[model samples]
Target: MHHARSLTALLLTVLTLLAASACASTTPGTGSVPAASEDGAFPVTMTHRFGTTTIEARPQRVVTVGFNDQDFALAVGVEPVGVREFLGYPAPDRPWAPEGVRGKQLPTVGSQDLDLEAIAKLEPDLILGINSYIDDEAYGLLSGIAPTVAQTADYPEGATPWDKQTEQTGQALGRSEQATKIIAETRAAFDAAIAEHPEFEGKRAVFLLGSSAAGFYNLGADDYRTGWLTELGFDVDAKGGEISYEKLDTLDRDVLLGEGIAEADFKRDLVQQLTVVKEGRYVGLGAFDDDFAAALGFNSPLSLPFLLDIAVPRLAAATDGDPATTPAPYLG
Candidate 1:
């Protein structure tokens, strides 16, 4: 009987040790261990406009403070502790955020009026500010909280191409290969759309936004949003200059893209006078769903796929240049 009791105690001890080992192996970023890369090497260094950030290990607690980095984070399988808040976004995640992170309770961060102290409290191991217009002072503070990455200086604000932004975000998270695949997939979709609509080639396109105060705003040629047009074989007609209400007629293009009727400064006389409008080459993007306009503004990978599927049909219709016909299939 005494010998049997000894064996039982020994078995109990082995089971306890096994449980402890399992808990110890839990991944910090996600509860489960991330899938293997080419070799499982880490401690990667990423360089940005601010400087270089060396991530000692895969970040367990990530925070994204920009328009699109959170989408990249989610796409690359890292759930961020916090994400930047966007205008008209009722929840922490944007409507177009990845399915895994949607409806999450992520804290909101970033913006000129950013709550720096709140971000600090999140205790993030990594902070991604790429695709954000983060100046030096903000960078200094965020770097103090953790290793931070910011947008490349080469691109203008809100203009980082989606592929560059995605690849950089992937590199930061040690998922470069995955990022490349995502880029290729998105590129394939764009290519397929172009293949389907050969008329989009050589078309002059412009995407414009407006507000009551700003009157009319157009993205520069450098803007990533403009890349959507270029990638689809359209020749973007961006002037890379400030377009005002007085210059409303200056939007010379075969295909005119705008957010809303009010934001596009579609004043009755102004609309009638514009050549694109008169030619029915105007695509009032808000006519489909105002959120499509917002997604274009955000310009993230998560939103890109959704935008591509819907925007292509509308664009193809407008490129026909029939004055009486609207992009009715999508407009309704």
Candidate 2:
């Protein structure tokens, strides 16, 4: 009996030891050791107009004073802790912001003016901006908060193509490869759409925006929005013609006018003056559901994909016969 009791006690001790060993071997929450890449030095260096910026390890927290920068960061799979307030013109809602970032919960730092004090409160490891809005004075202020980058292209400070801007910003965030992939994928998607709808080939189109004060600005060939249109194989209007703030007597060739204008007035004044308008070739594009026109003004990384999606269908409709059904022939 004594021998049997001693044996049972030994068995219980062995079982306890085994259970404790198993529990230790299995990680508590994740079930595996944390990856080296997840918790190691991932240094990246970026050159911008403000100068060289080096970030050690991936930034866990980010802030953006510009919409485009915020968009790029989201595309590369990072959500900014803070971003500029959703300006009203680009869709009453921020359709382009990441699914998780919406409503008043994300915190807004006022407009593009960049609320430095508000941003400082967030304690972000990185901050990003673009175009003339981020001047040397702003840069000094932003850098004091965190690493900041600005647009570097020579083509009028604010007019860099979306793809180029994305590539540059992605590099700064240590996600150049991912950026390249996104761009290539987006281009491929566009090319496929163009292929599916051959009517988009060689179609002439225009982008028009009207201000409450400044009549209307006709987007020229050099404009970033035009570059997007041209990518889908549209023949963009020449910027050589002067933009008139005064009421126009005529609308001309292959005009793609903005919505909100009285169609009858446009027909009588602007439409009758242009030869194309007389021929009934004018196409009127309304405010896109995505607020693409307003988004373009901000020119952020978040807006590029939205721009492509919006332009593709609109261009297809303007050039193609039945936007809902049959594809139309090219209108060059």
Candidate 3:
């Protein structure tokens, strides 16, 4: 009986030690681990434009306030308890990235008008706003609610590069390996497309957006959408602003792309008669869903691969210099 009691005590001690080991996480960031991320890698520290944020322990409940941050988290198996919506844009994750939000209908937090109370109600342990355009005042409020990670001051306020944004989200979640894999895959796709289309090299390309009411605007090389064209080896030097209807001729380049521009609007501005359009080098951005547009804007790991499939073929057709080929037949 005494021998049996001794075995029981030994088993209990082993179990106790195992339990203690399981919970000893929250290590400081030393960059010692590989991109796959090390177990117990937190508390991870990331410095953005606003300041530095260190996530203590792996998060259970996260809230993504950044417009496209959700997609990054979703790409690496972290779904937020709440997500920011963009003016009726279908949860970008649903179509572009379904793995993270698969069958999980996440709550809409807020857009430009952040709902601090709603976010707090979600009880998020981590608040990711890397693309949220969060100001100092807003950052204070969010950090008050939970540890908030804002966009890198490295790029324009709202325009963090997709790869860096992915890595940032990964580090915050303690899953850098998954982030590295996705980034590598996406970059490989771009490289493959570039190799296939040497003609795309050194060509001038710019993406413009316009409506009959809003006129037209240009996205320069620095813009995320235009940056994709730059990745494909286009010489994009757009100044990144409005392109008046009268000055439409200024956008004349090797390849011209636009979103929401109607054939009537082009005809009204006599843009259809431009050399770019006349030579079949102009490509309208997407189909009715504007998935292509969302992919261009989100420009996240999930969307870029999706974007490549839609963009490469249309760009190839448009840049082939065959006016007979239609880049977007549905648009016409």
Candidate 4:
């Protein structure tokens, strides 16, 4: 299946809309033709929640307005001129993505506080906001400067599947073949890990992150934070709520996985005595523990391998069903 049937429909609809005279079915990520040449790839059009945007030619200067869209662009080798900063974390220079910006000075475009003036100054031909929260008004304003694309209706905001995001970015950049390769490689790594850890299946698990005075919170189904864990074949039980320290016992499961809770945070008697913890099956990481924390946010094709490299080993050690095996030596 070199081309996805659904993506083919999208390409056909767009091509028919523009009345493209003749072409066979397109490569899924590559638009209009099978492995379309840079010139043949456009006037390619992509439909999103904001509407259809037709790239008349291959984009020379693109800007990514979504917090996570830059990773998708970087995955496909399109170095965005400007990238929206996500959660105060530096982009391009991020630990999870070493080859993304590669020391090119990419200006920040403000994540939630999008600076339209800065974006317009960059003079981008294509604006990618596929993982963003650009409303109708903002989309119109961005479109005024250049063709602007917001998130598609198919995916919930901030929770687009990594593969789909990569595909659209590839189509937008006319680099679909490269995007397909990256996706296959990333999935293969996860698949290999799944094969190695058959014990992970038929088990219960929960993922929690960070803490507050009120309680520590777990992510919901739509949150990208838990997507990888779910894919690894665990019945990832996302509670979708916060639990106070006193009620931490309820998070008990075969394996407790999470990020941002320090080793000290688990020192409490209530946490230490939990069945999962006593069995040495908890793998929690500090916010600044390593690059895994930031990679969790990106969750793109480029960042997936970085996450798996660190996570799979730790999780495997924890879930080996042996109490003597310590998941992380630092996590007391």
Who wins the lDDT comparison? 3
Ranking the candidates on lDDT from highest down gives 3, 4, 1, 2
Model 2 lDDT per residue over 1-332, tens place:
01233333344443454445445532221211112223333476667677877777556557777655666666655666777754444322577765655543556665635555566566666776754356665666567657776777556656777787777656666667667777887677667877877876776665555423434566777766567667767677666244553544332434364533444545444445655445444445444333655555545546656655655554555454532432222221
**Ranked by TM-score, top first:** 3, 4, 1, 2
User: Mind giving the per-residue lDDT tens digits that candidate 4 earns over 73-120?
Assistant: 877777777788876665556665645345556787666667665665
Write out the backbone clash pairs for model 1: none
What does candidate 1's lDDT look like per residue over 1-332, in tens digits?
01233333344443454445445543344521255542353788887787888888876778888866777777666677777766545434456766666666677764445555556555677888886666776676667667898887777776778889888888888778888888888788887998899998888787776545445667657667677778888886555555766677777788888765573347656666888877777776774236676567666666777788778887877887566666643342
Q: Looking at candidate 2, what is the lDDT of residue 56? A: 73
TM-score of each: 0.81, 0.71, 0.84, 0.84
Q: Give the Cα lDDT of each candidate.
A: 0.69, 0.57, 0.75, 0.73
TM-score for predicted model 3 compared with the true structure: 0.84
Candidate 2 colliding pairs: 68-300, 68-301, 71-302, 249-269, 250-270, 251-270, 251-271, 320-328, 321-328
Q: Is 1 or 2 the stronger prediction by lDDT?
A: 1
Cα deviation of 155, candidate 2, in Å: 3.4
Per candidate, the number of residue pairs that clash is 0, 9, 7, 0
Q: Least accurate stretch of 10 residues (summed lDDT) in model 1?
A: 1-10
Error of 4 at 176 (Å): 1.2
| Candidate 3 residue lDDT tens string, 1-332 | 01233333344443454345446553422222234445586888889877898888887778898888888987777767788886356763446676535555578776657766567566677899988876676776678667899887778877788889999888898988888989998899999999999989988886777656446778786677677888888887756887677777887888888787766786664677788888888777743347777777678888888888877888999888778886863231
Q: List the lowest-lDDT window of 10 residues for candidate 3.
A: 1-10
- Comparing 2 with 4 on lDDT, the higher-scoring candidate is 4
